[model samples]
Target: MKQTATLKFIRKHSALAPICLIILLFIRPTYLYAEELKLPDIGDSAATALTLTEEKMMGAAVIRNIRHAGKLVDDPLLIEYINNLGNKLVSVSNNKDYRFNFFIIDDMSINAFALPGGYIGIHYGLITASRNESELASVLAHEIAHVTQRHHARAYDLGKSYQVPVLAALIAAIVLGSNGNELGQAALASIAAGSAQMRLDFTRANEKEADRLGIKILNKAGFDAHSMASFFEQMYKESRLYGSQGPEFLRTHPVSQNRMAEAKLRANQMQLKQPPSSEAYYLIKQRIEILNQPDDKALLNHYVLQLKNKTYTVREATLYGYAIALLRNKQLNQARKVIQQLRKQAPSRIAYLITEAQIAAQSQQYAKALYLYKSALDDYPGNTPLTLNYIEALLKQQKYGRAKSILVTHLRQPSPAPKLYKLLALIESKLGNQVATYEALAHYYYHIGQTHQALNQVNLALKTPSLDFYTESRLSARKKELQDELTALAKKPS
Candidate 1:
C-alpha cells in the first residue's frame, strides 16, 4: 500500500524531475516508524541530541530558502497581525524562553507546519478556511506544542544517524512541495521515493499529546478550547467529502474520528472560554482575499457585488477590501470614497488610514500623503505599516535624509523585515553612498538566503576606495561572519 501511494504521488507530480534528481542523489530508501522509536521524556536528553542554537540555525536556513523562493506573504499588516496573535499564545506557553517567529505562506492550501525551531508558517488558505480566530489560534497552539515539546529533537535523539541538514531539507521540500511548483513537486516526489509516506508523520502519541496540550494552551490564552475539536471535525468532514483529495493539512496532520472525539472530550472537561474574534482577524482575512485575486478587475467587481448585495459578514471589512481592490485597479476616486466612509465609521482604524494615505500617494499628492502618514503615526506611534508607508512617501518626495533617519530608527527594533533592508539599500544608492549601498544590499541578500550574492556584495563594499577604520573593520567582520555561515552550511552532510 505504501508503494502504491508512492507510485500514485510520482504519477501525479511528474514535473518534479529536477528536484527529484537532487533528492535521489542524497537520500537512501529508509523507513523509520514513529512507534518503533522511543520518545525521550521532555528534558535534557533531547536537548543534548540537538542543541537549541543548532535547531534555530536550521530553522533560519529553511526560512531564508522559503523567502528566496518567494513563498512567504510579505505584507506587513498580515505579518504583524499573525505575529501578535502567535505571541499572545506564546506568552502563556510553558516554554517562555523560546523565541517564536510566525509567518504566512502565500499558498492557497489549507495547511500549517512547524519547523525544528520556534518558526511556524500558516498558509493563507488556512486562515481563510478557519471559521474564526479561535480555530486559527488552535492550530497555532498545536504547532507551538510541537516546538515546545521538542518533538524534532526527540526524533533526532531516537534516529541517531539521521543528518540534521537532510531533515531540514526534507522539511523545506515538504513545505514547498505542497504548493505544486516544479521544485516543490520534485522534492515531494523524491521524499516519497525515500519514504513511501509522502507526508510528515509525527507519532500517534505526539499528536494526542499535542492535542491535549494545545487545548490547555488555548483555554489559558482565552480562546475557545473546543476549537481544536471543531477544526478537527471540519477537516474530518472534508476528508469524507473529498477522500484522498482532502486539504493539504489533512495529508500532513492526519485527523481521525477517535482523535476528534478525544479532543472534544478533553476540551469539554476544561473551563471553556469562547472569546469573540478580533477585528484584525476579519480585516486581514478580507485583505488576503483581495490580495490573492490575480485579476484586479475581477476582484473589484467581486467586492462591488458583495457590497451591493450586502453579502458580507463584516460590512466594514468588506468595504476595506473593496478599497484595496480599487486602489489596485488605480481607481483613486472610488477607493478614496470607500476609505472615507470607513474612516468616518472608525476614524482611528489603521487599515482605513493607511489605505487613504496610499490613495493620496497613488494620486501623486505627496504632501497630502505625507501629512496623512504623519498624522496617523502621531496617533499610533511606531506602527510598522504606517512607518513603512511614511518612509515610502518620504522617498517619493526626495526627503532622503528624513526617510533614512526614520528607517534607521525603525531598523533598531528586533527582526526588521528583509524589505526594509532592500529599501535602505535603494535609499543609500540614491544618496550615492556606494559603501552603504553595498552593505545594505548585502544584508538584504543575506536575509533572503542568497549567501553567495551577499558575500559578493560585502566584497564589493570592502573594495570601495577610502574606508574609515571603523567602517573597514565593520565590513571585514561582517564578511567573516557571512563566510563562516557559508562554510558551515557547506559542511552539512548530504
Candidate 2:
C-alpha cells in the first residue's frame, strides 16, 4: 500500500522532487507561487500568436549584464568558422532569426546558454570539452532550441515572470563583481529550485526534446549526429569520475539517467557513416585549448607536439592560435614573430592583418596600426569585426574624430548593432563634445544599463523617429527603474 502511494506521488510529480529537495535545503525560494503550479495556456500557442514584445524587452536587460559579465573572444577566423557551422544548423531550425549571435565568453566554465532573439554564450571550457565541431553544435542547437521552443516565455507565463527576476539577480551579482560562472550556477539553482519532481521534469522534458531536435538538425546539416551522444557520454563519465567536483554545467543542466540513455540510444539509432574529419576536430580542440590555457610551459609543451607533426594543418592553425593567445597574454614580441609567420603562410587573412595592426598599436606604433586598418577596410569592405577593431585602434590613438567618423558611417549603413551607440558615446566624450556625448551616453546607459540618465538620453535621441526594438525595450525598462528609484529618493528626502 505504501509503495503504491509513493509510486503515485512520483508519477504525479514527475522527476522534479529530487532536484527540489536538493535546492530547497540550501536557498530560500523566490517564486514559491510557481512551485508545481499548472498553466496549460502558457507557451502552448505558436510564437506568432503570442505577444513577445515584453519578453524581448526583458532579454535586452539581461543582455547588457551578459555582455558586461563575460568578455567576447574576438578571433574573427574562429568566430566565422563557428558562425558558419551555427548558421548551417540554424538554416534547418525553426527559430531562424533567433539571427543567433555566437561568441566565446572568456571563462573556463564548461557551459553554454542562450538569450532571446538569438544570443548564445559559449565558454572556453565548454569549447575544450567538445571533441569536435558537431559536439559544439549540439550545445548551441540545444540552447537555440530553448529560444525556439519559447521555454523562458513558457516559464514566465506558467510561473509568473521568473525570467526578469533571474536576469535582474544575475545582472546585480555581476555588477557586484561576482564570478560569472558562480553567479550562473546560482541562477540555474533558482530555476528548478523549489519545484516538485513532476514540475522539474516538465522542464527537463523540454531539454530532452531539444536534444532530440538538435541531433536531427545535426544529421540534416551533415554533421555527425552521434557526436551529441558521444559528447554526453564523455561528460557523464567525467561526472562520475569527479563526482560532485564535475563541471558546474552538469550541476545546472543535471544529466539525468534518462538523458544519458536517450543520448546513447539516439546515437546508435542514427549510426552515422562518417565522423567530422580529424582535422576539423583538431581545429576546434586546439583553438579551444590555446584560448583556455594561460601563458605557461603547458602551451609550449603542446606546441612541441604540433611542431613534430608538420603534415597537420590543424596543428598549424593551432600554432597560429597559440601565437594569438600569447599576444593576449602580453607576450608581444613572441606574438609578433608567430603572426609574421602566420601572415607569410596565409597572407590574405584579414584576422592576421588586424592582429599585426593590434601588435603595432600595442607597441605604440599607432600610425602603423591606423594604416593597416585603413588598408584592411579598403580591401575587405563591410567586415564588421575588422571595422570594430579599426575603430578601437583609432580610439586608442585618441583619434576621436576618425572614430566618430567611422561610427557615423557604420551607423548609417544597413542593420547596425545597438552596441554601436555605446561606442559612439565613448568617442563623443573623447571629442570633448559634452552635450552630444552625454546624449549618446544617456542612450547607451539607459538602454543598456537601465539608468535614469539613459532614459533621458533615449528620449532626447529618439524625439522624431522609430527606435530599434532593442533600444525601445531598454528605454521602457530604464524608465520604470528610474521612476521607482526617484520615488524611493523622494520618500527619503521627506
Candidate 3:
C-alpha cells in the first residue's frame, strides 16, 4: 500500500522525476563491489564523492524545479529579510568558504530543509511559528550545519553500494517528507522498508552533529543557545498535542526527549545571553501575515478587531499590518492616517515610509510619492526596497528614462532581484527599445526558471530589425547558453 502511494505521489509530481534523474546522472557507483568501496571519512571525504560544482548544479536544478512549481516565495521584502537573517548566522559559522543562499518556501508547513551546495530553504510557516528570532535562527543554523557538514554528499557516498535508483528515490523522499504530505510520508516509509537502515542511522548521527554545531553557531551569532533546545521541546510537546501528525519539521528532524535533553545540556554549557530581536523581524512577520490573507477587507476587519481588543503583542507591527491591510482594501485616507501615525513615531522607519509613499501613490499623488521615496533614499541610499519602490514610482509617472537609469544602476550590483529585471523590461518597452526590452525580459524569465520563455525572448531579440553588432553578439551568446542548458535538461533520463 505504501509503495503504491509512493509511486502515485511520484507520478503526480512529475517535475520531480527530472530532479531524481539529475542526481542519478551526477552520482554513479564507480566501484560495483561493496568490499572495495572506501566509506566516507570524518574530514571532507564527501567532497571526493560529490564535487562542490556538482552539488551546486544539483542544488540549482532543484531550486529551479521548486520555482517552476511556484513554491518559492517571491516577496522582495520577505526575501531580503530572510537573507539578511541567514547571513548574520553564516558570518559567524565555521564554514567561511562556502557561499550560502537562503530562500523561503511558500509552504505553510513548519519545516526547513538544506539542499546541496549551501542552499537553505525555510518555510514561511516556520518563520510565523517561531516565538522569536533566535528560534528561527536556530533552525537556519541547523540547516546550515547540514550543508557545511556535507551530509547530502556524505549520504551519496554511503549509498554507493546501493542501487542508484534507490538512492535517488531516497533523496526525493526526504525532500517530499519534509512537506508532511501523506504521500510523502508513504514514500519515506517505503524507502525505509528497503535496506536503508545504515543510511537512517547515519542521518541520526548527522542530526546530532548538526544540533551541536547549530547551537555553537547560534551562540556565536549572539542568539540564545538554548533556542535550539527550546524549539525542539516545543515541537515535541506539539507533537503530543497533534498525536500522529506532528509538525513537518519533526518528521524530517525528529525530536526526542533524549535529543532535547542533549541539546539542553549542550546549551547549558554555553555562555547564555538574551538578545533583543530586531524590529525588522516583527515588521516582516506582520507584512507576511498581510500578504497571506486572501481577502483585504476581511484582513482589515481582523486587524481592526485585534487593535480594538488590544490582542496584539507588538502594537507597532499590528499597526503596520493594519495600515497595509487598509491600503490593500483601498482605504487610502485611513491607510495614510495610520502610516502617518507610524511615521510620527519613527520618522525614518523604512516600512512606514514605504507604506506612506504607497498610500500617496495609490491616491494618485505621484509627485508626493516620488518626493517621499527620494527623501528616504537620501537617508538610506542604495537600499534595495527603497530603490525598487522609487523606480516603480518613476515608472508610474511615465518617467521611463529616470526609472531606467536608476534600475540600471541597481542591476549593476550583484544578484539583483528577478523582479528588477522584469521592471527593466517594462522600462525598456516603454522607451520602445525592442532589443533591450527583449533582453531584459529574457533575463527576467531565466531568473524565474522559465527557460523556454527566456529562450524565446532571446530569439526575439536576435531577430529584431537593425540590431547593433555588439547587441547581436551578446544576444547570440546568451541564446547559445540557454540552448545548451535546455539541451542538457532534455538529455536527462526520463
Candidate 4:
C-alpha cells in the first residue's frame, strides 16, 4: 500500500512521525486521530473560580506529585504526629467540620503553607524554630484560618485569565523544583497568598482575618492566644537581625508590627489559658533539630549550652537531644550515661527503650539491640518506629528471613507504610527472589506515583512461570488497577 499524503506531511516534521503514522493507520478511520490530546473537561473559564470539591481534587493530584518529588518527610512517625497536632487546632476552629491533611516538608526554610482543600505543609525548620507548642500551633491556626476563609479559592484567577492546569503546573514546580514560569510562580506565591503586589493587595485582608481567627483558635484550642503575637514578634525581630534575610515564613506571611500589635490586643482581651504541656511537641522538636544537623559541631555545642543552662522546657527531651548529639559526635560513654539518665527519668517509656536500643546498635551490641527492640515491640505492638528499628537490627545481624517475616506481617496491616514496601524490595533482592522483588518494587513505585513503572513491574511478576494461582491473580489485579488509575489521571483535565 502506498503511504498517504498526510502521513508524509507529518513525517517531514519529525523522526517519531513513523511511529505516529503507524498508530494513525491502525486506529480504524483516520480522522479521529487528528484531534489534539486534551484532558477531560475543565469546564468554563470563570476567572479564579474554583469550587471546594474541585479544589480538593486538584490538591489531591498535586500532593501525589509532590510526594513523588521527594520533598515530603519520609518518616511515618513524624508525618502522623504532625497531622495529629494540626488536627487538634482544627477541631476547635470555626471550620471544625473541614477534613485537613497535614504533612512535613523536609526543607529547612522555616516556612509553613496551607494548600487547597485542607492540605498543609510545614517545614522541618519551622518545627525547629518553635520555642513552644503554642508558637507552632499559632502558625498552623493562622494557616488554617486562611483555608477556612477560602483565601486560596478567593485568590483564584480574579481576572479569570489562568485555569486549573496552570495552577496545577505551578504547584508542581514549587514542590518539584524552584525554576518555573513567572506567571505560575506568581500564582503560587499568591497562594502562599502574599507574593506579588496584586497578591499582597489581594491577601492583606485575608491575612488580617487569619490573624484574628488564628488567635481565637489558639485560645479555644487551649494555647496561649498571646503566642500568635509573640511568635510573630520574634520573627519580626529576627528579620531585622538578618537585615531582610530572615526566615522564609516571614517573607511568605509578612508579619507587620501593626498586625502583631493587633494580635496582642486581641489576645489580651481573652482570658489566658494554660495549654497542657506538650511533651510530644518537645520530643519531636528535638528530633527535628537532630535531623537538621545530625553532626554539626556548632549545633551540638549550642545544645550542650542549653543542657548545661537547664533552659529547655521538657528536660527529658532536651536530655534526649543531648544524647543524640553525643552519639553522633562519637562520645560513646557520654551517650551511654545519657541513656541511663533517660531510663531513670522514664523507666518504661517507649522513647527510652528506643533510645537505649539505638545506643546499643551504635556500640555494635547487636544482640542487646535486638533484645531491646523485641521487648519494646512486644509492649507496643504495631509501633512503626520500633518495628522499623527491629528490622534494622535483624538486617544488621544478617537475619534476612526474620526481617522478611516481620515485614510481611506489617504488610498485612490496613494502610501499610510505603517505607515497608521499599524495605521489602531490598530484602527480597537480598534473598534473590526476583519475582517477589519486582512485586515489592511495583508497590513502592505505585505508592510514590510512578504508575507506568508499577504497571511494568506487575507485568514482569506475571511473566514468572513459577508463580502460584493466587499470586498470579493478585498481580493481574494489581496491573489492571494501575492501568485504570493511569487512564483516570490522563482523562482528568489538568
Candidate 5:
C-alpha cells in the first residue's frame, strides 16, 4: 500500500531524530535526571541518620589523602599514646559505632581540627600548652563531638554550592598542572571571597554546639567538666595578656567573655564524676613537655625557684619537664641527679627510667638508653612507641643493620605512622640507591624550603588531590617567589 504524506515524512526523519535526541540527552543530563539526582533535605534531623560506617570511610579517606600530601611526624610512641587516649574517649562517646584516631602533627601551631569521620589532629603546640590531661581531653572531646554530630557532612551538604569554586580550583590545577601559587591562590581566594559573615555564623553555631556536647561527653567519661571551662579560662586570660598576637589558639579559634560564661554555666549544669588521673595522662604530658617547651633553661630556673618556695605540684611538673631538658642539653650528670630524686619520690615511674636512658645515651652511655628502654618495654610490652624508641637508640649508635631488621619485622604490624617506609627510605639512601636517595631528598628539600622551589617541582606537588595546610602554604609561597623571580629576570639588561 502507498504511504500517506505524514507517514513518509516520519520514515525519512526517524534515523536522524533518534541521533539528535541522544545528543540532547548527553548534553542536558541535569534536565533529564534532575528529579532522580536531587539531594536529600539537609535538615538537622537528616544529619543524625548518617551511618557511622559512612562517616568512618569518609574520615579515613580524608586521612589517607592528606597523609599522602603532607609529612607526618615520625614518633611512634607519641602517635600510639595519643591514639590510646582517643580510644578511651571514644569508649565513652554516646556514638561508639565508629573508631576514633588521633594524630600528632609536626606543626607547632596550637590548634586542633577534625575530619568528617573520626580523624582528629592534636597539634604539638596544643599538647605542650595544655596544663594537664583534662585540658587536652577538652580539646579531644570537642573534636569527637564534631565527628559524632556529623558536622563535616552537614557542612558539606549545606554549602555544596559554595564548594564548587574550591573544587574547580583543585580540578583545574590537577588537570592543567598549574603553578602551586595559582592553585593555592585560587583556593584561598575562594575562601576569602565567600560570605564571611555566613561562614562565621556557621562556625560560631558549631563551636557552641561542640562546646555543650563536649562537656556532656567529658562528664560521661568521668572527666572533670570544669576542666573544659578551666582550659578555656586559661586561653581567655592568655588572649587578654597577649592581645591577638599570642599562641595560634586565639587566631583560628576565637574566645570571648560570653563563651566563657556559657561554658561555665554548662559545666555547672553537668553532674561530672571526676576520676583520678591515670598513668597514661602523666606519661603523655611528660612526652609533650620533652618534645616542646622552648625556654627550657628558664623553665628549669623557675622550677628551682618554685621548689624553694615549696610549691609542690608546680615543682613536680617542672622537675619532670626539666629532667628531659637536661638530657636534651647534654647535661647528663644533672639529668641523672634530677631523675634520681624523682625516682626516690615516685618509685616505679617508667618516665624517670626513660629519661635516665636518654641521659645515658647523651653521655655515650648507649648501654643504659638501651637497657632503660628495654626495662620500660618489659613493664609495658606491646608499647610500640617505646619499642621504636629503643630501636632508634640503636640506630643512633650506628647499628643500622639491627635497626633495619627490627623495622622490617614491625613493618608487617599496624603502624599509624609510616615508620617502616621511613626506615626503608633512610636505609636505601644510605646504601647509595640513587632512585631511593632522590625520592627522600625531594621530600626533605620540599619540607625545608617549602615556600621556595623550582617551578617544576612546586607545580608537581600541587597536583596532589587532598592538600594539607602545610603543602598548601608551601605551594602558595613557592608560586609567589617564582613569579617574582620571573618578573625580575624578564626585566634584566641581558
Candidate 6:
C-alpha cells in the first residue's frame, strides 16, 4: 500500500511532466499560444506539414524561448564537451550533413527531447543521473536518432489527422503560461478531454524506433551500445525503488520489460568497443553537480563527504569539483592549492586551465588571468570559453582596442558566435562608434531569432550620418538579409 502511494505521489509531482515531450508537437498543425510571445513563424499545418526550412524556423523560435527563460546551463566548457560528443554521433550517423545543436537545460528533471532542425536539450538531472559517459551518450543517441528519423514531422502529421488544436494549446499553456495550480489544472483539464492515451501511443512508437536506430548509432559511434539497455534497465529499477515515480523521462517515455529485453538482445548482438572513461565527461558531470545546487557550501560539504568516504565513481572529477566548490566559497587559497594538485595530476587539461584562469580573475590577479587565457588559447585556438574570457579580461582592464581586434578576428570565422556580436556591441559602445554598435546589436538580435528587431536595428544603423562605404556596404547587406528573414517568417502560416 505504501509503495503504491509513493508511486502515486511520483506521478503527481513529476518535475517536468507538464512540459514533457511537448517539443515534438512543435511545427505540427496545432495552434500554439506563441502569439503571446510574438515569436517568428511557429510553423503552420500545411498538407506537407514540416519542411526543412520551416523546421529550422521553428527551432529558432523554441531556442529563443528556452534561452530567454535562462533554463540552459551558461557554462561554455560543458556545452563544448556535449557538442563534441554530439558531433561524434552526427559524424557517424546517416545524416552526415545535419547541423546538430545540443544544449543543456538547468532543470534537474532526468529528461531529454529533440526539436526540429537537429536541436536537442538534455536536463542537468539527466547528465548527473548517468552512471557512465556511455549511458549519457545512449540517451543523446536516442534523441539524435529521433531528430534524424524525422519523427517529429510524422508526429505532427498524426496530430493534424487527430484535428486536436487543443492539444497544442495545452502544451503552449504549460510552456508559456503561469505556474502552480494554473499549470496543473490546465494539464488535467486537457488530459480529461483529450486523447492522451493516443498521444502516448504515438510517442511510444517514436521511442521504439529511436531505440532501434540509437543502439545502431551507439555501436557505430564506438560507444558501448550495451550501456543503452543497461541504462534503461537501471531507470526501471530506479523507478520501482522510488515508488514508481521514475525520472521525468520514464514518465513521458514509458519503459517495459519487453522493450528492455529487446534493447539488451540487440546490443548483445553488437560486439562492444569498451571506450575508456571520458575525463571531460566525468569532470563536467561533477562540476554540474555543484552548479545545479544553489548552496555552494552545502554542496561543498556533500562533495567533501563523498570524497572522504572514497565512494565516488571518479576520484579526479570529485577533486576537481571540490576545488571549484572551494573557489565558489571564496576560499581562494584552498582553491588554488587544490587546483595546483589537480594540475600536477593532469597538467595538460583544458578544464584545469579554465579553472586556474577563473581563480586568478576572482582573486584580482588580472595579469595572471590574461597570461593563462592567452596561453590556453595558444593551445586551443578559437576555444569559445578561452576566447570569451580572454576578451572579457581585456575589457575589464579597459583595453578596448585589443579586445575589439580579437573580437573582429573571431567574427571573421564562418559560424561566429552570437555572443561575440554582443561583445562587439559593448566594445563599440565603449569606443562611441554609434553606427557600429547598432550594427553589432542587429546581428546579435538576428542570430537569437528576433529577425524583425534585427532589421529595425540595422535600419537605425544605416540612418547614421555620413557612414563610410565599407561600413555602409556591410550594414546594407545585413539589413537585406534580415528583411529576407522577416519576409519569409511573414509568409509562413502563423
TM-score of 1: 0.85
Off by over 4 Å in 6: 1-49, 155-209, 412-417, 446-456, 468-494
Error of 2 at 265 (Å): 4.4
Candidate-wise lDDT, in order: 0.76, 0.60, 0.73, 0.69, 0.58, 0.70
Error of 5 at 445 (Å): 11
Ranked by TM-score, the better of candidates 2 and 3 is 3
Judging by TM-score, tell me the better candidate of 1 and 6.
1
* Candidate with more favorable, higher lDDT: 5 or 6: 6
Model 5 residue pairs with clashes: 77-385
The number of the candidate with the highest TM-score is 1
TM, every model: 0.85, 0.68, 0.83, 0.71, 0.61, 0.78
How much is 342 displaced in model 5, in angstroms?
Answer: 2.9
Off by over 4 Å in 4: 1-57, 94-99, 148-169, 175-177, 181-209, 240-243, 294-315, 329-331, 398-417, 428-435, 449-452, 466-494
Stretches off by above 4 angstroms in model 1 are 1-33, 36-47, 157-170, 178-205, 489-494
Query: Taking the tens digit of each residue's C-alpha lDDT, what string does model 4 give over 371-473?
Result: 9989888887877778887997898888999999988998897546677898898899899999999999998886665668889999998998888989989
- Write the number of the candidate with greater TM-score, choosing between 3 and 5: 3
How would you encode candidate 6's per-residue C-alpha lDDT over 189-240 as one tens digit per residue?
A: 4444433322211334555677888999899999999998888788888888
Q: Which residues of candidate 5, in runs, are more than 4 Å off?
A: 1-81, 105-110, 124-131, 157-209, 233-266, 272-312, 344-350, 396-402, 413-415, 427-494
- Predicted candidate 5 versus true structure: per-residue lDDT over 1-494, tens digit per residue: 01132234235444322322222221111112212325343345344333565455444533433343453455655777788777777778776555677887666656666654567777777886777777788888877876776554433321432332233232222212223244334443443344311110133455577788888878877788888778877877887888655665654455667777888899999886666666556666656655655776865665566567776444555677777767666677988999889888876666666677777877888887887887777787656666677777977777777666665665566433444455555765566554443333343433332223345455665665677788678667866765553342232121
lDDT value, candidate 5, whole model: 0.58
Q: Model 5 reaches what TM-score against the true structure?
A: 0.61
- Model 4 / residue 345 / CA error / Å: 1.0
Better of 1 and 6 by lDDT: 1
Winning candidate number (lDDT): 1
* 49 Cα displacement, candidate 4 (Å): 6.7
Which regions of candidate 3 are displaced past 4 Å?
A: 1-7, 10-48, 155-205, 492-494
Model 3 gets an lDDT of: 0.73
347-459 per-residue lDDT for model 1 (tens digits): 98888888999899899888899999998888887788989989988988889999999899899987789999999999999999999999999989988868789999999
